[model samples]
Target: MNRRTLLTAAATGVAAASLPSMAAASPAMTVKDTMNRTALYRSSARTQLAALRWGSTTARGLLEQVLAHQAEVNPGVNALATLDVAGARAAANRADQYLARTGRTLGPLHGLPMTVKDALETAGLRTTCGSPDLADHVPGKDADVIALLRQAGAVIVGKSNVPPLCQDLQTSNPIFGTTSNPFSPAHTAGGSSGGPAAAVATGMSALEVGSDLAGSLRLPAAYCGVYALRTSRGSSPIVPTRGHIPRPPGWLTSSDMLTLGPIARDADDLDLLLDVLAAPAPADRRAWRIDLPEPVSRTLDGQRIGVWADDAYCRVDTSTRDVLEQVTREVRAAGAVLDESSRPVDFAASNILFQKLMYATSAATAPDAVFQGEVKAADAVTEDSPSALYLKSRTMRHRDWAKADEERQKLRAAWDAYFETHDLLITPAAPTAAVPDQSSVPAPERYITVDGVRRSFYDQTSWINLASPVGLPSLVMPAGKTRDGLPLAIQIIGPYLADRSVIAAAKALAKLLPTPPKAPGLMA
Candidate 1:
């Protein structure tokens, strides 16, 4: 997912189910998601749409519920920045009118409400992008995904918050303060999509659209104990780039990494949204009526899975590791053959090269008037210092980026080889579990805390790069929680573009895991 505006992209809440259930209470992979009434915060596009049809709630009614909830709890949790009561009400009213006049539907998302990330424009609504400069800017056209959702009848609820230019993993900007994790308000909801995560985790809305470049979407999902899909890069309709973007066509193929998809409460719900978003742009495949491919696994009965809980490059918090271990054990006990073997993958080099290409992509270019930041940084560089490396990388020559590209191909090839023997792989989504806010930390120093403990600010990207570089689909699902009650998650990665198969595996594995604990923040 492209979490930052640099990629110019695409872009949930919660409540309880009041429906009666005769099904046995057990680990709800999708069932707990559909049945949990304590308000576990993240919303599923599938669940929301189903509720609209089955519960007689209009778009306006759902918006009213979130607005009312926000009024009572937003001050305590700090999730929303801008709420589009009027715009959302207007959209909801239109949906209600449609339902009244015509039994026919607008699309799959009729009457669903989604809180959009502010980085993407929402016509007629302010899109601040967490920058003071964009605090009042409003584009005439909606982002591609927004228009698609609208066609499907998703009411725009208003803009969520982000970090400035989405330069940090923690969400905090001069315009919007910070988004705290619902599990523990002092910790983060994870950025640059934190606000949406916080909002969804607090039961504010049912679904959210967020982007991820460097684990933004997945990290937030993990911390919030929700399900998030970071699809193979370019799976969703690509958004146009803005200022600082260079190169012909002004389109970015940044490491061919990063993605945009859905964040919900379970695997099936996550798939429901992913399918709707996967429709090729109207111009591209609507005319041809493209169909989605099935999941890679024949069935979960005897599937072969490769799992890596931790690695030498990054240390997973014990809780996160434990959750995955349990998931692996459960899957095995359920009859799937689990492989603890390491495949022929270049994780260390993949990450190192990814860093070079990623930062270069971020520092892509500047206009004549705004070249000051680059000039100052160049002048500030001392011989052979880290700044010099940055300067050299920033102005990356074709040969330099090509070198990284070659390495990327090698990594992709390595993945191809690995997949020949295994159908799927699982690992920790991030090294830590919603650590203290890191907004004030410098990029380089971000990896090394002021306390002198070394950690990779980019470490979260380690496992993410595997899926991204190869353009593979990865699903992040809650494995369980920590002794302290924090959420822990695992990533299920499938062959590039084999999304359906990954969904099947997650559903089967979900049946094996323990019942995830109910969150404590549902009271709000």
Candidate 2:
């Protein structure tokens, strides 16, 4: 069958029976029961690979479990936009046959089934980028990150949903509709990686690879109670912009602050995927090699950690602050050296600089007509008017971008100096937990309530923007849950090239917190 036919079959739920039956057929946890639990998904990527190697479960069986799960829960949440079951099953069968013939596994992720964000290019699968213009667009080649996952023996099942061009704070597009939070359909899943976060959280997919710019990866992961790593800028040789949309097909450049990384159920899974994705791209294999240093320390004892949970620029909600205070007390009790006073650079200045750079970089993707219109409108406002910053930055000249870039460099240097004394920095990932779905409203007009005070829709991303412009390695993990049962998360920022340190710190912090509760409405 053609790719389109297969996707149609999967979407209609007619492809579930095509999946191979389990080898043992013993009673196992039902998909609904698994969805209502706080634990990691039934089987993680690592566990599935080990089972594949040990002959306890075949690759086809595992793939079937994933597909069945997706079919069971996706109807309500709408996390997955497209399902490539036929192709994924074929890949799983090939893996099972190869292992039987050679008595050896393929790679680190051998036989694991996972999904990619809709914004990424997947060979033979539609990549809409949540835009109606590209709703039917399919790529003949996969993104660099997808290629790495394929090399590591991952069976790509389908694509997850995203906001249009991944521009909004919530996941909804003209094509696949909105992705609701798995815990509560009334709340948003967070975007532009929202679909992937929801899928990983509810066992619809074992792992996910998503892109980040302005907290696209971390915020969604935070909202969904999963682990996400925002890779240090340029640390991985894989070119993210090549297959990502908003740059358009065949476009060579991407946003300056954009990055691609893994989202998973736990820190160890994030670490596992990071090792596979950190390699040099095919073009750089001949001469370029990257050797990232090990984390500064494994234990929390004696480690100098900085806590900036709340700032004058963005005040977190009461529940979020409570979680941070609890984490602080626990980290101190564990013998870690905690500093609540020192801060790197000024929040207000750094945030302004980040917004300018972010808007300037995105202007490249704008059409000629829109670009000219923005330039005309920007000319009418005074240079110092705060309201004109967005328009001015979007239409800024090369000289202006150069000036903003210099300011970014200064901020990066300041962060570098601060890290000389601190091993990790802990802060709130957002001002509030996952808010009610606002996908129906235009992004600019949307609003959120934090501690009963109404704030701009854009405030959700304010704290996360701090890590993007400076290219710091940031990881988000579930810190605790709010009184309303929503997931509360913390961001761990480490020095540049210290990706492993942040993950290490996150793993340690995870041990201190209670297991997060599963989303409501799922059968026990």
Which digits, one per residue and each the tens of the lDDT, describe model 2 over residues 257-370?
A: 888888988898888999888767667779976677898887788999999989978889999999999999989998899999999989989888999988998888788998
Residue pairs that clash (backbone atoms under 3 angstroms), model 2: none
Least lDDT summed over 10 consecutive residues: which range in candidate 2? 16-25
User: TM-scores of the models, in the given order?
Assistant: 0.84, 0.93
Please report, in order, the local distance difference test score of every candidate based on alpha carbons: 0.67, 0.82
**By TM-score, how accurate is candidate 2?**
0.93
Model 1 residue 482 CA deviation (Å) reads: 1.4
- Show where candidate 2 strays beyond 4 Å: 1-41, 234-241, 383-386, 520-524
Candidate 2 yields a Cα-based lDDT of 0.82
